[model samples]
Target: MRPKVFVSQPIPEPALDMLREVAEVTVFPRLDRNMSEDEWIMAAQRADYLFVMGGNIITTNVIKANPKLKGIAMVHRRLPVNNSIDLDTAKALGVPVVFQYPWEPVYDRIAEATCDLTIAMILDLAYRLIDADRYTRSGRTLQEHTMALMGPGVTGKIAGLLGLGKVALKMVPRLRALRMSVLYTKRTRLAPAQERELGVEWADQSDILRRSDFVCLEYDYNPSTHKMIGEREFALMKPTAYFINTARGRIVDEPALVRALQNRTIAGAGLDVFWHEPPGSPEMAPSEEFFKMDNVILAPHNGGATWDARTELTKATARQIVTLIGGGRPEGLVLD
Candidate 1:
C-alpha cells in the first residue's frame, strides 16, 4: 500500500501531481493563514509523513501524537530551533527529517541579478529616463541622480556574509566577478585556505558597517542577531550609503529604518522582506512612499520567483517525499 502523506499547506500544481503518483496525499481543505496547535496535532495523527513550510509549528506535543509518522519534510531554507519541526522529538522517535535545498538556485540567480540591478541603480539609468511617451507630453527632462549605497557588498565585494553558510558560498564568485570584495564576521572564522578559495576576507562587524556602501544582511536570525541593525548601526552608515536587506525583516529595526530615511541618515535602502509579512499598512504595494522615495527599492520577496528556481525547489521537495516513502534516506536530511 502507498504511504499516506498530509500536506499542511498549498503546494504548486506540479508538486501535487508528483505527490499523487507516489503517495495518497491529503491536503487540508481550506487554507488557514496560520495553523492552530490543535489542527497540527490532528494532522499529525492522520498521516505517515508531513510536508511543511518554515513558518509552520511542529511542537514536541504534535510529534508525540503521530505514532505512525515517519518523516517531516521541510521546504523552507532556514529552520530555527524553537519553531517549526522539533528535531529532538524526531530523533527520539527514530524518524529521519528532511529539508529541501530550495533556495540554492534562487540565491545564485539573485546574487547575479542583484549585481546587475546594483550597477543600474548606481549608474542612475532609471532616473535619467522618463517614459518616452510621457516626455512628449511634459516637455521636461528628469535629472539623473546617483544612489549612494550604504553597503559595499555589490561593488567593493567587501560584503560580510553574516552567516558563512550555503547561500554565501554561491554568492561569492558572482560578487567577485562584479569587482566586489567579500568580508565576513562570524562566531568562528573560516580557515585561511577556505577564505582564499572564495576570495573572501574577514572584517570586524563594525568595520563592515562603517565602510561598506551596501550592507547585505546574510545572517540568520537568533537572539543575538535580532534587531542587529538598529538605530546606532544606521547612524554609523555614510549619508550616501544604501542598505539592502534580502535576508529577513526583523534583522533591521523597521522603525529605526523609517527614521533614518526620513532624516537622511543613510541615502536609501532596498528591502525584500519586512518585519511583518504582508505588512497591513495603508500603503498597498511596493511602489508606495515607505519604499519608493529618493533612495529605496522594494521587492515583494520575489527573489526566488523565477520559473527555474521554483521548478528546482518543487522537484527537490517531491524527490524528498518519494525517498522517505520508499524506505530510503531522503537526499538532503537537515534535522537529526
Candidate 2:
C-alpha cells in the first residue's frame, strides 16, 4: 500500500497531483482553506507524511499521535516565525522536517531590484527618462530629487545590503554601480574582513533614518521587533525620505505609519505586508487595502508570486517530501 499523506492546506494543482501519485492523498476539504486546531491534529494522526503550508500548527501532541508519520514538508518562500513548524518538538518526536524555500535567495534579488527601482523613483530618474521621451512635446525640464532612507534590511540593502545571508550577498555590487552608499545596522557584531567581504559597513540605525534618501524596512517581525519603527523612529527620519516596507508590516506600528504619511513624516510609504492579513472581514475574501490612503501602496502580498517562481517552488517542495520519505536527505531541511 502507498504511504498515506495528509495535506493541511491547498497547494498548486501540479503539486497535488504529484502527491496523489506517490501517496494515498487524504485531503480534508475544509482544510483546503484553513484548518482548525482540532482538525489539524486529527489530520496529523491519520497520515504517514504531512505536507504543510502556512496556517497549520504541528504541535507536540499531534506529533505524539502520529506514530507512523515519518517527516513533514513545508512549502514556502519565506518561512516566517509564526508559520515555522515547531522544530524542537519535531526533534523530540524524531520526525525529520524538510523545508522547500526555493525562493529564499530570490527574495534578496527582488529586494535589491525593488530598492534600485525605489531609488530611481525617488531620484526621478525613471520619471525623467519618461519625461525625456516627450521632452519636445511637453517642454518640461528633467529634474533629480534627494531622498533619505530608513531601516537596514533586505530593502535597505538595496541601497546597499549588510549581508545577513546569501540573499544579501548578491546586492553589494549592484548598489555600488548605482552610486548608492550602503548604510546599515545589525544586532550582531562582525569583523572588518566579513564587512569587506559583503562590501557593506555598519551605521547607526537612526543615522540611516536621518540620512538616507530612501528608507527600507528589511528586518523580521517578532515580539522584540514589533514596532521597531514607531512615532519616535519615524520622527528621526527626514521629511523627504520615501519609506518602503517589503518586510513584515508589524515592524512599524500601522497607526503611527498612517499618521506619519498623513502628516508627511516621510514623503510616503510602500507596503507589501500589513499587520492584518485579509485586512478586515473574512466575508470580503481576497481583500486588499488600497482604499485606505493615497500615499500608501498596499499590495496583496504578491511580491514574489510570479507564476514561474511559485510553480517552481511548489514542485521543489513536493520533490523534497518525496526525497525525505525515500530516506534521502533533501536540501533545505528545517530540523537539524
Candidate 3:
C-alpha cells in the first residue's frame, strides 16, 4: 500500500502532483485560513508522513502521538527552530525531520522577489504613484498647475534599513540607482571596508529613525524586537518622512503605528505585513483604518508570493519529502 502523506497547508499544485505519484496525499482544505490544532492531531493519527510549512508549530504532543510517522519534511530558509518544530522529540523517536539548505534556490528566489517588492514600495511612496492612480480612477482629471500629486523625490533622499539581512543586501543597488543614500542598522556593524564598498553608512537605531527620508524595516522579529517601532520611534522621524515595512507585522506595534498614521507623526507609509498574519494564514484581516488613509500603501504580504518563488519552494520541499519517503537521504538538505 502507498504511504499516506498529509500536507499541513496549501502548496503549489505542481508539488502536490509530485507527491501524489508516490503517496496518497491529503492537504488541508482551507487555503485562506490556518490549519487548526484539532485537524493537525487527527491527521497525525492516520498519516504515515507529514509535510509542514510556514509558522506552524509541530509540538511535542503532535510528534508523540504519531509514532508511525516515517519522516517529516519542512520548507524554510531559516532554522527549523524558528518554526517551533520539536526537533528533540522527533530525534528521540528516530523520525527524520528534513529542511532545505539555508542557501537553497528556494530562499534565493524568495529574497529576489521580496527585494523587488521592497523597491516597488519605495518607488510608489516616493512618487505617490498609488495615490495618483486612485485619484485618476475615481474620475478626477489632472489639471494644470494643481499641484495635487506632488511628493518627495527619491533622488538625494536617505533610505534607512532596519536590518542588513539577505534581502536588504540585495536592495542596496536598487536604492543607489535611484540616487538615494543608504543607511543601515543591525546588531552587528559591518566592517568599514564592506561599508565603503556597499556605500552604506552605519547608524544607530535612533539616528536612522530621526534622519532618514525613508525608514524601511527589513529586520527579523523575535521577543527582543517585538513592537520595536513604537510611538517614540515614530515621533523621532521627520514629519515629512515615510515609513515602509516588508518585515513581520509584530515587529511594529500595530496600534502605535495606526496612531502614528492617524496623527500624521510620519508623512506616509508603505506596508506589506501586519499583525496576526502568521504563515499559511490567508484569513488575516488588516486594519480598516489603513484603507481609509490616502497616505498609506498596503500589500497582502505578497513580497515572496511571486509564482517563481512559490513554485521553487514547493518543488524543493516536495523533493525532500519524496527522498525521505523512498528511504534515501536528500542532497543539500539537513535531516535530523
Candidate 4:
C-alpha cells in the first residue's frame, strides 16, 4: 500500500500527478482559503506526509499530531527564511523539513518571473497605464494632451533597489534594458568587482531614496524589515519618483505609504504585496485606500504567479517530498 499524503493547498496538476505516483494524494480543495490550525492537525493525523504551501499554519502541535508523519515539504523564499514551518519541532520528532537552495535550478527562472512582475508594476506606474485604461473605459479620450494622464517615462531614469538579492539582481538587467541606471543597497555591500561586473553602483540607502526616479523594495519580510519604510523614509523620496513594492507589505508602513500617496509625497506607487493580507485569495486586502487611488497600481501579492511558474514551483517542491518518502534524502536545504 502506498503511503498517504495530505496537501494543504491545491498545487498544479503536474505536481499533483507526481505526488500521486508516490503516494495516495489528498489535496485540499480550496486555493483561496487557508486551513485553520485544527484543520491542519486533522489533516496531519490522517497522512504519512504533508505538503504545504503559503498561509498554512504548521505549528509544533500540528507536527506532533501524528508521530508517524514521514516529513514535510513546501516551496518558500530563500533559505533561512522566517516561514510557517515548525522546524525545531519537526526535528524533535525526527521528521525532516525541506527548502530550496538558490543553485538548485529554481532560483534563476523563479527570479525571472518575479522580476517580470516587478518591472511590469514599475512600467504600469511610470506610464499611468491603469489610469489610462480607466479613463478610456469611462468615455474619456485624449482631447489635446492636456496632461490628463502624463507620467514620467522610464528612459534615462534611475531605479533604486532596496535589496540586491536574487530577484533584484535579475531585475538589474531588465531595468538596464529600459535605459535606467540601477542603484542598490543591502546590509553588506557587494564587492566592487561584482558591482562592476553587474554594471551596478552601490549607494547608501539615503542617496538611493533621495535620488531615484523609482524606488523598489525587493527583499523578504522579517523582524528587521518590519516597517522598514515609514513616514520619514517616504519624505526622503523625490516627489517625482514612483515607489514599487513586490516584496512583502509589512516591510513598509502601510499608513505612511498611504499618507505619501495621499499627499503626493511620491509621484505614485505600484504594490503587489500589502501590509495586511488575508488568507486564501487577496480579495480582502487590508489597505482600502490603495483601491481608491488612481496613482496606485495594485496586484494580489502574486509576483511569482504565472501558470508555468506555479506548475514548476509546485513540481519542484513535490520532488523533495517524493525523494524523502522513497528513503532518499531531499536535495534541498535540509533542516534537521
User: Which candidate number has the best TM-score?
Assistant: 4
Better of 1 and 3 by lDDT: 3
lDDT of 1 by residue, 1-336 (tens): 888888876666688788899999988665436566688899889888888754567778888997778888877655444356678888898777887665566456545554444334432322322223244456665444324322333444344455555555666676677687777777888899988988888887788778766566667766888899889988987776667776667677888998898899987776777776522221123334474465566665555555555555666777789888877777677644
Tens digits of per-residue lDDT, candidate 3, 214-329, equal 99999998778988999999999999999999988989988888999999999999999998665424346678988899899898777888888988888888888898788888
Give each model's whole-structure lDDT.
0.67, 0.62, 0.85, 0.83
lDDT per residue as tens, model 4, 108-178 = 66677889999998888888888778777887545657588888889999999999888998899999999
Error of 1 at 113 (Å): 7.8
Candidate 3, TM-score vs. the true structure?
0.84
**Candidate order by decreasing lDDT:** 3, 4, 1, 2
lDDT of 2 by residue, 225-290 (tens): 887888998898888666766656677787788788888887666666676642121212221333
How accurate locally is residue 137 in candidate 4, as Cα lDDT from 0 to 100? 83
TM-score, one value per model: 0.63, 0.62, 0.84, 0.85
In TM-score terms, candidate 2 sits at 0.62
Estimate the overall C-alpha local distance difference test score of candidate 2: 0.62
How well does candidate 2 score on lDDT at residue 151?
Answer: 29
lDDT of 4: 0.83
Better of 1 and 4 by TM-score: 4
Model 2: ten consecutive residues of lowest lDDT: 278-287
Query: Candidate 3 local accuracy as lDDT?
Result: 0.85
Which residue pairs clash in candidate 4? 32-280
